[model samples]
Target: MLGHPWAATELGPLPTWDPAVRAATDLVLASPVPMALTLGDELLLLYNDAYAELIGDKHPAALGRPAAEVFGEVWSMPGVGDVIEHAYRTGEPFLEKEATLPIHRRADVAEQSVFTRGSCAVRDSAGRVVGVLTVAAEITQVTRQLQSLGDFAAALAGTLTLDDVARVALRYALTVFDADRVSFAVDEGGGGWRMVRRVRGELMDEADERLPPLWRRGPADWPAPAVEAARRGGASYVDDGEPLRGIAVDRHDQKVRALAAVPLRAAAVRGGITVGHHDPHSWSAADRALLAASAELIGQAAERARRFETQHGTAQLLQRSMLPEHLPDLPRLRIAARYDPGVDGNAAGGDFYDAFQLPTGELGIVLGDVAGHDVQAAARMGQVRAALRALALNDPRPDQVLAGLDRLVTSLGAEGATHELFVTVVFGVIDADRSQVTLASAGHPAPLVRRCAPDGQARATYVDVPAGAPLGLGSRPVTRTVPFHPGDTLLLFSDGVVERRQQGLDRGLATLAEAVAGAHSGDPRALCAAATAAVPGATEDDVAVLAVEHALRPSRSASMEVPAEPTAPSRVRHWLTGQLTEWQVPETVVGAAVLCTSELTTNALLHAGTAARVEIDLSPERLLVSVADSGTRGTVTRARTDTLSSRGRGLGLIEDLTDAWGTDPTVRGSTVWFEILLPAG
Candidate 1:
């Protein structure tokens, strides 16, 4: 600048400069700080090498040019222009921290730089303010890194699942690393891998319809750096020379110039996380440290989520395995049971139910709650259920069954060296003739009975069974006989079914009774569902419920499992014809019943795509037949048949032939039934 003509034109020859101008110029040029001297009324810019590098590409030309013309874009920003003007006018020094300047590195590229900048008025020999002298230190990298980490930590704190951790980690990695793509892969415990990747702000995955779209599986060997990191048990870096593989974000052969991969050091899970850049870049010490810290956080979160999932799944499987798989499908009684685990905790709670046939042709029903949530509780429940079934088989009396269970529970508590056992159970015996049910309770909630009167109105009331001291404590339980006749349904359930958090047990019981009364009384499956669903929104403890409906069974009652084949409907028709003829049913009634039942069976097999169970109950006055399938599809509603146009072609025949017909949705699938009036007695 000293020998340049432009510099000489702006401030004269170096030998002719004023004393103060020369001294100020020496001070500005020698300073290590980024200092710029804007001299005279025109405010021509002069700066040291440090300041020249800060202003990129405008150095030599900016040497003898006005500060306003050289930095017009930056000078127009809010903090830059106002602070400089204030110091120039008042001659008072000023300082600003974290001031933002939008700098253009090239014609097509722009960036925001933050700095701690200070400015003071420059004076001539006459002591009059001429221009502003500014000094600044850039702090953009440190500031942005801190801000991004704060946001990343806040986001990670709310994650409770592996998928949540992957989503959050991948999203923030893009910002922290400023990379073109980021990927998170998890080991499938086998030899496979499931990966979720985000490239250029868009997530990439394989076109798989079975998996969720955002997290579709990727090729196992696509991310070579991540796979290598996992294999090496350490972080991996690739500055260049590694070609990209796997599913590309845009085209088949997108290139990557740099990569960083970190292995997840989790105890229960093994995987790796990676970030890739499309342009060549070097990984600095600070960049490697940040990536390792992020990987640590992800590993810890993944371990926590996997532990929870493993415990929860194991507990649920153990509890369900202890309970009955298939209930007794009887001719005189219809039985159904349901069990729902609590919403909180991973331990298995003490709720169980079972229905089995006794040696004397009677049915034994039991529901119990042993007091806690843990493996011990589930084990204790299994003991109680097994003991009760044994006692009922030996005596076939409700009160005697409870007495034997009391002894067994007392012995169990004695065997439990650390904690005493507390159990409440309701044991009932349904007579072989379906005339009545004898119930005995050991400090358990009374069983409920829903009765349909001659007027066809159903009412639900709790059976007045005697309550005694809970098992493990000494007390005698008395038996109460309730008239569980035809069209009357009995419900036995654990306290979880009628005890809610923040609500009284009485209110929950009343709500259950109302739900039972409103449900169809003839279908035990529907009754059990309604009773369990009476209290909404995630029960705090496990729920176990059993429903038994006493159907009017005369001399002729039969059941058959319908196969999913073309011959199923014809076989059902032939079987029904023989059964009705043997029972002395009239030809007209038998013909109509056979035709309607065949159509119902065909619908179940065609639409449900599963095996169907057909049950028939014949009385002197009417014949009732039903077809139930385990599939959830093909449910029929009355509105569907309100008009012939909307009714299914097969169901229209059922509606025309039967005296009364309807459909009841069950816990597993659905049941469609029709009643045919027999000839006059």
Candidate 2:
């Protein structure tokens, strides 16, 4: 008041002050608590040294200013100005405890302050109110501590994994308590503890060499002061004055000067937490309480995550055991298969696929689904797959295989199987050489056929096949034969591909067909991947898909008849050579083709004593030649021979020159065939 020139201009000099204000000033200066006085209608401000420190940088200039000008930010708060006016008007006292207000203390930002304010009217000689005397104490730190606790509780509620819980607890501890490093350790149940440590918000691995050796110590060892405190289940602090030989060091290679440790407790597990500082410091009760609360939350989350992982692992094992270990390799066809369980990781579903060779030398493909998604469903699927494989080995026809499966399912039901156990399967046999597919559906979706038309454009269309009752109902399945030429593909899938919630089967089928038509690659793997990627939403059920594509190759075949005489071999060789020349087969392959054809033709006519028919097939990679005659010969074994023996050398010579050779018995004749790989152009 004596030094500021504004004090003289803004209000009258100290000698000319009001009697009430002079008396209030004398009382404020004598008090040890914060005190301020505003006198008259202008509400001029006057405060002692204790109150001056509370007002921060505005102290000296605010001494003689009006209350509205000095405390403008806080004047409009809920009860601030009103309480002062009420006290001055009625000569009564007003009090508020822990009242919140936005006070401008520093120049850069306005801080939220909680205060206890008591205001009373200052009276003159006639007992009339002249000014207001207010005393205030700030409690902002206490209010912020309570708020931090609430926020930490809410943040820990939504974490689902152990790692997520650890990260959240460490982050809040560093931010709320203003600590430099946070570490969490959980008991691993065998005298071991798994620890996660973070320094300045970055997680550090146990293998990180930059960390102190104390971090890598075992659970039974408590040489470090922090670990001993956690083991004893109370808060403890370590400083540079304590033992520092085994403790961890900071980035500066100095022992951690200050550290606090707390124990974590939950229903199922026990753990610990440690917080450290770079410089020497003291531990406050508030800091210990916050760390202990965070540790408890982390313990609870770890227990829940452990249970989830156990269930997920069991479900995965069951599903994988029921699926095929490997797919079959077919001769002119490519196959791709995939199976995906339900999105919920704990429940195993019943979708499966199988590709294997049948007794008739044809490819048997099966895609099926049982009507549930549980452990029992998975077990039933395995049984169904085993039965299908056993039945397919005897019968290669699709309808016959399904009929056998229906009988097996009926027998199982009679033997006390559940009525809810039902299966829908699409069984098909692919004859790559004949370019034909025989498919049968047992209450399953029809397979899709993607064909390259004569104009060289690809299009997809679903096979029109009749569906019968599913397996457990004992209905006979109907079979259909579809033409599958080179550059064509066949797709068989479970209902998950074409059956979605709130959508019709026809709509999903159309979507799948469109995706297949737009695919540029005819490779089975590529086509299957593209089709699955085009599905619109999350799959509600398990998915299983099997795709097969017949590759295109430059091929030609010719057949002719030869007389049952000595001239038959010579005439057949000449005819085969001429045909190969006409087909533009290379000269190098024509000679070998004629030689193999002559040897087989001569043997067929002489041994069977009948006229022979010659069939030759030329592909880009190999040549297949077959000679058929009227005989039912069973074995076509090669006879051993020496250089001097000419009678048993025909079969041996043929075997040596051909890549592969076999014989098949027809209704009235036996046909011998050999394959020789053509030379690369």
Output the number of the lDDT-best candidate. 1
Candidate 2 structure, TM-score to reference: 0.61
Flag regions of model 2 displaced more than 4 Å: 1-6, 9-64, 70-74, 87-263, 270-283, 329-333, 404-418, 450-458, 485-489, 497-506, 523-529, 551-681
Model 1: per-residue Cα lDDT at residue 224: 55
Per-model TM-score on C-alpha atoms: 0.60, 0.61
For model 1, residues 1-681, the per-residue Cα lDDT tens digits are 675564445566677766777788898889998998776666777899899888887777788787778777777777877777777788999988778787765543567888899999888788888778999998888678778877887777766556668778887897778888888877766766777677674522221111121444445454555665775779988788554655455542277768888998777787788888987889988888888878877888778767766776566557767888778878778787777666553458788888999888889999989888877788888889988888888997888888999898888887776446889999999995858899999999999999998887899999998878898788589999978888788999888888877888889999999988887444666676678778765578878788898876533568999998989999999998998899889999999999989988987876566799998877655787989998644236343233333125456678778766766544455688887767667
> Model 1, stretches more than 4 Å misplaced?
1-183, 188-228, 234-261, 274-291, 309-312, 343-345, 452-458, 485-487, 520-522, 551-681
Q: Would you list the clashing residue pairs of candidate 2?
A: none
Per-residue lDDT of model 2, residues 1-681, tens digit only = 555453454445677656766777798988888899887777778888888877888878887678888887578676888788778788889888878877666764687788888998887766777788999987677677678778877877765445556666776777766767777776656766656666664533322222111223356664544456556766676654433345545552244567777777665655677777777877767666766666776666767755654565465557656677656655577676656555652367888888888777788999998888777777778888899988888777788889988887777777865687688998999888798999999999899999987886879999988878999798689999989998898998888877778888788889999888877545565566556655688777877788987867644667998889998888887788889999888887788778888888887766566898898766665677878887533225445433222324666677677665655433355667777767767
lDDT of 1 at 57: 77
For all candidates, the clash counts are 0, 0
